[model samples]
Target: MARIRTIKPEYPVSEDLASVSLPAERTFVCLLTQADDEGRQRDNAAVLNGALWSLRPEHTALDTEDELRQLAETGLICRYTGCDGRQYLHVTKWHEHQKISHPTASRLPACPVHEPAGWCGKCKAKGKGCARPAPENFRSLPEALATPAEAISAQRPCTAATDLTPAVDVSAAEAAAPGKAAG
Candidate 1:
């Protein structure tokens, strides 16, 4: 079943995301909610249409298939046949945007083209590396979806979230207390 997914506010302005047609953009956004915790799903257009565009009778499975091709071509998503010979797709930057607290393991096989050899959805082998490391080609965080700290630092020097003090008059607050002096 599909799981909840995050859509950072920066999505609409992303150069790579904006490169696609509006329909394809909508498809991409909708696909976010439809994806598994690992950002994977079956690559059947008909199934996707039934799940994603069911309310909109105007859209068809063929349209979804075309959008999928557009997403793949733009490197937003990866499509491949698993070892079981079933087709699957995964968002290329799943980890960059999502911060699932307790992600469930994916039942689908990993894409061989993107994953290390003998990868079994787990980073088990010594020195094999992360099972789903972010792609090297990803743009810097400022231009892409960034974590809260990255976003803050991109605009200014990094500071802990707690360092931000609330705007209030301390003397007035102290005066309001029954036993405190205004000074």
Candidate 2:
């Protein structure tokens, strides 16, 4: 009978701690920083939503609609309820791209027919129109029509031609005569 040889498997043993190079450590740090930045952005958005909810609970649903859509597109906010209630705003499922940024640098200019042209109604009535347009331009139709003539006329030119013409300063009159304008 021939003699058979047996071979033993060898395993390596380590004694010193594994050393990670400075560059590798740096790479890890950079990854952590990016993760932290993303987290902070999410937190900021939550705070903004909370503030809006506090200010106008009724409009809370609409306040974050645009933001929510953006999140969905970017895979942030995965699912959201649409205004219709039947359709769901799914970021990943959307066929078309939706704009995630602010609609404009600022809110759209108020409708000239409804909003005051220059300043507050009190100022308009006193013939001292506001230095700036009213901040609250959104108002009901009844309210817009009910504004005081003095407030409306304050900013209006003395010429009768422009009297009936709709001007941007209409909000001033509406603010002054809430009963008539807001009715």
Candidate 3:
């Protein structure tokens, strides 16, 4: 099964990322997507590069070492030698983005960075991550929101005017009310 992964806003392109070409970008994304829920993977250059290139033969920009170096230089990945005398990688901003409900033991040695405490709504509700039970008011969400995938799939692409009217119609009585309609 595919482990869940996190993707930040600037994940595709950033200051440290812009320097690398498309090949490096693809390889990095592949590793991140295939990594464990904790954003860790074996730091074997040959295996990574071979898998990446084999998957996308057209992407022949950067070699594995060069791509790994780029990722490390950008503070996106941290590679280290484990007690087993093998290298491992850890994405720096993993926890900040991903909320793993079931985290597995990392085979690599610990390289934890101390972070200041912050509010975790789930933690206060006796949960590890955001997998807490919903309140009683749950399932009251509107149909569109409750089944977002179906709603999204049912939508047709609108390439017309940007100032389209609201989908929710306002009754004439409400529209005529004092200060209801803006100037």
Candidate 4:
């Protein structure tokens, strides 16, 4: 099933996307919607061509395979063979880019190379980097927003009640009313 996917403003500007052909760039974006909640999808060129480029008969499975290869080479996606002996691909920045409110369990197998067996979003290796990293052109939050509270607030509208900073001083305005005299 196809799911809604987000396209970051930096996607078009990404160096990886720029390196690939226009068809390959479109394929990369189309794969985002086709991927499961865990960003895993079948890597068969025929299936991808049928699902993503059916309207454009000119785009053949061979073209799709070439696009997939470009995406894998650019580090935009990781292609691996599952234990089931089937080809699969995982979007490298799916977790970082897609904010699924209630993610559905993935039916596809995780990438053995990028993700450990039975990987559940967290990595056991302390020093090693995670499978999902920010895109090449995207910058992560600064050190000031490293905290959970600050990070959460940064995403939504901030009010006096929910804001991390000190609340407004309303006492001065209250005391300066027309009926009240200044002390």
Candidate 5:
């Protein structure tokens, strides 16, 4: 009987070994393939393990000292300066005094809370405060008009259901009924 032999498939080579002897073009291809495989593996692992996976690749094997220095000089990629004078990666400063110019001769300081308020209709109609108005000149008419009317009304409805008697008719009712008390 003839002797039977079996050959096992070789596992994919690590990136370090592939980069060492490959030509520049081949090395790039190998590096890209390795990165893709690593990413897929990491994603699979994350799914299987039920945990957060780092999206940013570990660059230790690919990066040289020069590459690291270059990245460092470019500053933090996601940092922003907050109004509280702190360097934050997520929260940003809101400039409440930012000005918006109208098509006419006006500019208004943007309110951080309400934001733009559609070019201040009253200011546009009045042809004033179109742009960068002085604090003294920044009187907002719409804000004044927005007050609750019920709060400022001079007359309020009587809450007592039994006190339906009109103020002028109370004396007339007492005189007609004789024994009825006037309240």
Candidate 6:
């Protein structure tokens, strides 16, 4: 379930997000930063409040809720009832903002336009190819993979597709065995 989230450096200016109050701006960013690849997440104010507390300690649950409400009103995010009957928040501009290579199917409701592009080379055929969420520790997807979630020694390099071993010289072997054909 570990993945990355990318926010272009020009997003704030390009999106005109500076006009909103600081808290609302932060909330919107948090929503994007914490959400899964499709920009959908449990629409629980308490959970969101907990996530934002470190950044804005003086803010309360009610404040976060208000900001989320504003985001919805402003067309930045939308709330929908999942098939499971639980409410979730889906960022309206997720696909517009992100460049997903070949996206997987989203768990959220249908969007105004097409969903993001994403493809998991390993799971695209059967359709389990949606983009995954980033880990809690990193800001986004790539950092998590590059730095790793656990100890360095605990990790293993993924080299299944390529070989990097040094090639050995066969001249010595041929010299040692004159009569034996080089099998």
- C-alpha lDDT score of every prediction, in listed order: 0.74, 0.29, 0.59, 0.76, 0.26, 0.62
The TM-scores of all predictions, comma-separated, are 0.63, 0.16, 0.52, 0.64, 0.14, 0.53
Per-candidate Cα RMSD to the true structure, in Å, reads 20.1, 27.7, 18.6, 19.4, 24.8, 15.6
Model 2 agreement with the true structure over 1-183: per-residue lDDT tens digits: 111212113201211101333322322222222221111112133343454344655544333544443343344223321112212211121122233232222112211222224222222322232222212221112445535777777776476654565665666666788467443
Query: lDDT per residue, candidate 4, 1-183, as tens digits?
Result: 888888999987899899999999999999999998889887788999999999999999989988887888799998765545566789988899999999886656656566664443333333232333223322222455368886677886676777574475557579678997656
lDDT of 1 by residue, 32-81 (tens): 88887778887888898888899999999888888887888899998875
Q: Which ten residues in a row have the lowest lDDT in candidate 1?
A: 132-141
Query: Which ranges of candidate 2 are over 4 A from the true structure?
Result: 1-52, 55-62, 79-85, 89-183
Off by over 4 Å in 1: 121-183
Q: Which window of ten consecutive residues has the lowest lDDT sum in model 4?
A: 132-141
Better of 3 and 6 by lDDT: 6
Tens digits of per-residue lDDT, candidate 6, 1-183, equal 434667878876845466567788878876776777666677778788898665667888878877877677677877654334455677887877877676666545432223334333223432242433322231112444534534553575544576865597567667698688665
TM-score of 5: 0.14
Tens-digit lDDT track of model 3 for 99-131: 888787443343323111212222332212222
Candidate 4 residue pairs in clash (backbone atoms < 3 Å): none
Number of backbone collisions per candidate, in order?
Answer: 0, 16, 0, 0, 5, 10
Among residues 3 or more apart in sequence or in different chains, the pairs in candidate 5 whose N, CA or C atoms overlap within 3 Å are 106-130, 106-131, 107-130, 107-131, 107-132
Model 4 residue 57 distance off true place after TM-score fit, in angstroms? 0.7
- Evaluate residue 89 in candidate 6 and report its C-alpha lDDT on the 0 to 100 scale: 72
lDDT of 3 at 102: 79
Better of 2 and 4 by TM-score: 4
Q: Lowest-scoring 10 consecutive residues by lDDT in candidate 3?
A: 114-123
Give the Å shift of residue 56 in candidate 6.
Answer: 3.6
In terms of lDDT, the best-performing candidate is 4
- Which rank order by lDDT, best down to worst? 4, 1, 6, 3, 2, 5
Please give the lDDT score at residue 78 for candidate 2.
32
> Candidate 2 versus the native: TM-score?
0.16
